[model samples]
Target: MKTSDFHYDLPQELIAQAPLPERSASRLLHVPPGDACFADLHVRDLPSLLRAGDLLVFNDTKVIPARLFGAKATGGRVEILIERLLPGNEARAQLGVSKPPQPGSRIALDAGGEAEVLARFDDGFWQLRFQVEGPLEAWLQHAGQLPLPPYIERRPDAADAERYQTVFARETGAVAAPTAGLHFDEPLLAALRERGVQTGHVTLHVGAGTFQPVRVDDVHNHRMHSEWINVGAELVSQVRRTRAAGGRVIAVGTTVVRALESALVDGELRPFAGDTSIFIFPGYRIRSIDALMTNFHLPESTLLMLVSAFAGKQRMFAAYEHAVRERYRFFSYGDAMLLWPGEGESGSGDLR
Candidate 1:
């Protein structure tokens, strides 16, 4: 399919610049497969909408402070977005500057430290060695700022530091927050538990490549960036039990979908702990995730393609049209949508 197929018109005003006052206060759009009808709801309605046997899988990957502003030795400005943190106080990051720094040149960090540009990779990221006190994580905790999505117009503030993170966040590796999980709060989790809706967690360290755009017209030519994912045995057992008990596996975000689907071995879901560059588009045979609950995505984005794959291309397009018409918020801090798998335009409302 062509990348242009996923394009849609979104008003700039509809793009949420900041999060709502409450985590569960954002709007929710429920689109059942194959119909023109959809329900307008809120994030707090999730527990009531789901059945007792339904399992809601959440991505607990914590968003780290990856954005660091610094100045070059030549007095030029530089911005570093840590894509991956390695051992030895080293990192691979997307270095932003008018003129790229030379190898061995140090950039003065705003975090009271400096990093040397060791080398540049073919992927356009620079290998950097930091001269900081204590561990890199500790240093970042005291100095780095939260990395907001590119769609956000303003700079991150105190609210973003807490709002960008989920209540269940534990693992600290992701550069971007899984926007879908941002809707959940401790009270909502308690409500889900009270409703007998089971919950599980997976970790997928989202990289800065999540913001990368598709440049090719033919989507088949596009290659997805690999991100680290971890699926423990507990989650595997939960999935098996959910299936055996006739429950639905509702993936909270696309990240969980990738992690669970990538863990499939010999047609069975197994524990996985590694990196995955799995790309899901139209015509993909999805073996995991009975439903998806996620925020609205950008026009012609890989995320939109994923939802189109999970639902149907036409179905998703129709939903986007409806969302725009209804003045629904768009992007990272935007409203959410719940979708069930169905045939594109041709089939009835039976969820696969």
Candidate 2:
């Protein structure tokens, strides 16, 4: 498939600039399998939409304040977005400046700290060794701003520090929040629990590259960004037990879908802990998740392609049209969708 295969028209005003007053207040577009039609619902209605024995897998990766502003010794301004933190006090980052800093150049941080540019990584990330007073994460927590997506017009404010994170967020590493999980609050989770729906968690620290556009026309030529994922043995067993008892494993976000599918080895789900660059496009076989609950995505994006792969391409496009016609919000801090695998798709069959 071509990258253009996923393109759709979205008005600039429809892109969500800020989060709603309440997380569960966002709209939900439920697209069932083998149908072009969809049902309009809200995030709080998820409990009624799903069955009692259904299991929801959520991404527990927490979004960190990764945006930083600093300056070179020559007073040249520089912006840094930490992509991944490495061992030995090193970090992989994207540095924005009038000119790329050379190796050995030091960048003076805002909070009376500095970092020396070590080298560049294979994937175009700059390696830096910080000389901060405390740990880099701690320093960032104090000085950095939340890394909001480009679509959001305004700057990150105090509300983003709490609203951008999910209720279950614990492991702090992601530069971007899993927007689908953002729709779930304590009340919503409690409702699901009371309805007898089981819940589990996996961690996939989403990187800044998630917003990178597809530069190539051929979908197969695009390369996915690497993100750290951990699908524990307990979750794997939970999924197996759910399947045995005739329950569906529903993924809360695309990150969870990728994490669970990447953990599949030899046609069965297993525990996995490592970085993955698994790219799911149309025609690709999905093995782990049964349904997906996710936010509407950007046009021609890898995320859209993954949804097209899970659901049928034509149906997914039609659903997007419906969302546009009804003026549903788009992108992060936007409305969500409950999607089931279409008939004849890889994830449509029963695991048992």
Candidate 3:
């Protein structure tokens, strides 16, 4: 399919600029199996929507304050977005500056630190060595700002430091949050537990590339972004046990879906820890998840393509139309969708 196949008409005003006061108060559009019409509900209703024994896999990769402002030794202003942190206070990052800094050039940070450009990759990323007093993570906490999505017009504030992160966030690595997990709170998690739903965790350190647009006309020509993922033995065992007991494995976000699917070995999930560049579009049979709970994606994005592959392109477009007509919010800080595989799609069957 063409990249344009995933495009939807989302109004500018409908793009959510801020998070709701209550995490679980956001809207949820339920797209069930077959040709059933979409159901508009609240995120708080997830416990009731899911059955007992179902495993909801969540991505626990925590967001880091990765955006920083600095000036080159030449005094030209530059902006940095850390893509991946590395050993020895080094990192791979994307730089925003009038002129790209060459290797050996030093950038003096606004927060009283420095970074020396060590190398540049053909993909537009730069490797840098930090000149901080202590650990890079600690220096980043004091020097960097929360990197909110570009669609959000306002600057990141104190509230965003908390609202943008999920309550279950523990493994600190991601530059962006696994947004579907953002709607979950302690009370809601408690409710799901009381409903007898089981939970498991996967770690996929979300990359800054998640926000990059699909520039190719032919969807198949686009290369997917790579992210670090870890699917542990415990989670793999949990999935097998759930399937044996006839319970569905529901993914909380696209990152979790990617993590789980990438770990599949000969149609069975295995423990894996590595970087994955797997691209999911129509024609790719998803064997990892029975349902997906994810936030609304940008028009014509790779994320939209993944959902189209799962729920059918036509159905996703129709649902997006309904969301727009009903004044539902859109994007990272926006509402969410609870989706089951469409008829004839891989993993579609009696979910009960």
Candidate 4:
């Protein structure tokens, strides 16, 4: 499919700038399989839409304060967004400056300490070694700012430090949050458990590349950036058990979908811990998830393609049109969708 096939015009005002005061207060667009019409609903109604024995797999990757401001030894200003933390206080990051810094250049961090540019990659990431006194995570907690998505168009405030992360977030490494999971809170989770709905977790450290636009016209030509993932044996067994008991394995976010799908080897869901660059488009068969709960994605983005692959392209387009007409919020701090696999896909139909 062409990358342009996923394009949808979203009104600028509809892009959510701030999170709702309540996490589960966001809207939920329910897109069922086949010819069924879409249903407008609220995120709080999720428990009623799901079955007792069904499993909801969430991405527990925690968003970190990955954005930092610093200056080059030459006194040039620089902004850094850490893409991935490396061993020995080193990291791969994207740099924003008037000019790219060359190797061996030292940057004096605004929060204190320094970082030496060690190398650059063809894909726009730079390798830097930090000179912090303690653990890099600790230093970032004290000095770094929350890396909000570019679309937000606002500086990080005190509220964002808590609102941007999910209630289940624990494993820390992500530069961006698994936004679909952001709709879940303690009360809603308790409600789901009371309904006998099982829960599991997969960690996929979401990277800044998640926001990268699809540059290729041919969707197949696009390459996804690698993100670290860990799909543990317990979750794999939970999925199997859910299947055996005639229940769906619903993914809470695209990140969880990617992690679970990447762990599928030889037609079996296996435990996996590694970096994955898997690109899922319309033609790609998804064997991992029965349903998906995700936020609205940018036009022509890899995330849109992934959803188009799960749900039908035409259905997704129609759904987007409806969402726009209804003024549903979009992006990271936006409303969400609960989508079952399209007709002829790997999952059951009309889960409700």
Candidate 5:
């Protein structure tokens, strides 16, 4: 299919400029697959709608304050975003500067010192080891700012320190927040736990590429961005046990789905920790995950492609249209949706 297949019109005013007062207070719109009818609901209705024996899988990857600005030795400005920390104190990063930074050049950060680039990774990526004079993690907390998406068109403030993260966040790695997980609070999670819903966690450090536009005319030719994911033995066991007991595995976001799917090697899920560039689009058969709870996505985004794969292309667009007509808020700080596999896309054993 062409990239234009998933295109939808959204009003500029609907793009959320600020987060809602409370995370759970955001609105939800539930749309059934292959149908046009959509019901307006609240995010708190999640636990009530899910069955008791279902396993709710959430991505526990934490977003680090990875956006850093500094100066090159020549006094030119440079913006850096830490993509991943490699072994031996080495780090892979993306650099945005007036001119490309050269190897062995120094980037002086505001925290009293600098780092020198050892090599160039790719087009705009650099591999550098820090001489921070202290631990890099501790240095970042005091120096870096929140890595807000470019579409936001504003500066990060105190509220973003808390509002931009999910309550379940634990392991620090992600550059971008798994926005789907942001809606669940302690109370909501507690309620779900009390209702006999089992929960499992995985880590998939979301990358900035998640928000990148698909510039290709043909969607199939587009290459996905690489992101790190870890699925431990414990998570693999939980998913298998859930399936054994005829319980559904509900993935919290597209990131979790990729982690779970990437771990599925040789027709069975296994523990996996590495970079995955898996891309899911319409007509792709899902090997795992029965249901998906996620937020409304950007137009022509890969996220829309993943959701469209689970729900049929026609059904998914119908749901998106309903959301637009109902004045539903869109993107990061916007509303959410609960979806089951479409008629032809049965997630569990109930194929139509």
Candidate 6:
């Protein structure tokens, strides 16, 4: 399908500049599975909306401060946005410099460190190895700034230190947060546990490519940038039990959906760990997830395409228009929607 099929007119003011005072204070648009429907609600009303048997699958991949300012040895200032970490201390990063830095050169970051360009990979990324006093991951946690989406104009403030991440964040790696998980706080998790709504976590370190715009006019031609995902025995058991009990397996975000779906093959969801470049477009089959709670996505984006696959292109776009018409905030630091799979792509669809 054409990327334009997913487009909508969003008022500039609807783009959220900041998070709400309370994590669960954001609005929630409920898109039911039918031609005759949609309802607006609050995030706080989630507990009552769920049943005891329903499982809320969340992505626990923590966002790293991946965006950094640096200078090449040639004295040109550059910005490094870490995309994926290759094995053995090497990382694939996007170099935003006056001119792209050459291979095997030393570039010093403003926060205090230098990285040696190892080699250039396919496409725009360069593989660079950082010289660190401590582990590279720990250094990023302290020195880097939150990798907020480009649409968010201001530099990340102290409040963003907490608000941009979810309460359950662990297994540090994502450059971007799994936004649908952003709505839940400690109290909300406690509430879910108290209500017998099962909760399980998997890691899918969201990459900077998550917000990368889809350049293809034909959305299906776009290839997804690979990202790491892991679904363990616990989540599998929970999903199996949830299904056995006739309960819903609600995915928290597109990240969680990819993590679960990437592990699925041959009619079974195997525990998996590796990079997944799975681009879920329209007509793709969904095996495990029954519902989704996600933030509004950018038009003509792979993320938008994924949502369109879950909910139909028409329904999802209509819901997006509704959000815009109702002034629902947009993107990562924005309001969310709880989408029951559209009537055309509901439960028991093929995984492969």
lDDT of each: 0.89, 0.90, 0.91, 0.91, 0.84, 0.85
The segments of candidate 1 whose C-alpha lies over 4 angstroms from its true place after superposition are 344-352
TM-score of 6: 0.95
Cand. 2 TM to true fold: 0.97
- Worst ten in a row by lDDT for model 5: 343-352
User: Model 5: runs farther than 4 Å from truth?
Assistant: 345-352
Model 4 has an lDDT value of: 0.91
Give per-residue CA lDDT, model 2, range 195-296, as digits (tens): 999999999999988988999998777878889999999999999999999999999999998898788888799999999998887777787888999999
Q: Which digits, one per residue and each the tens of the lDDT, describe model 5 over residues 21-88?
A: 88888888776655657788888888877888899999999888888878998999988888877766
TM-score of each: 0.96, 0.97, 0.97, 0.97, 0.93, 0.95
Q: Report how far residue 37 has shifted in candidate 3, in Å.
A: 1.7
In model 3, state the lDDT of residue 81. Answer: 98
Summarize candidate 4's per-residue lDDT along 1-352 as a digit string, tens digits: 6877787888999999999999999999999998799999999999999989999999999989999999987789999999999999999999999988989999999898999999999998899999998989878987899999999999999999999999989999999999999999898999999999999999999998887888888866777899999999899999999999999999998888888888887769999999998887776778888999999999988888789889988889999999999999999999999998888644321100
Q: After superposition, how far is residue 156 of candidate 6 from its true place, in Å?
A: 0.7
* lDDT of candidate model 6 versus the reference: 0.85
Write candidate 3's Cα lDDT for 20-92 as tens digits: 9999999999998878878999999999898999999999999999999999877899999999999999998
Model 6 agreement with the true structure over 23-112: per-residue lDDT tens digits: 999999998887767878988878877889999999998888998888987789989999876666678888888787777789887888
**Regions more than 4 Å wrong, model 4:** 345-352
Model 6, runs deviating above 4 Å: 346-352
Cα RMSD (Å) between model 1 and the true structure?
Answer: 3.3
Give the Å shift of residue 85 in candidate 2: 1.1
- For candidate 4, the TM-score is 0.97
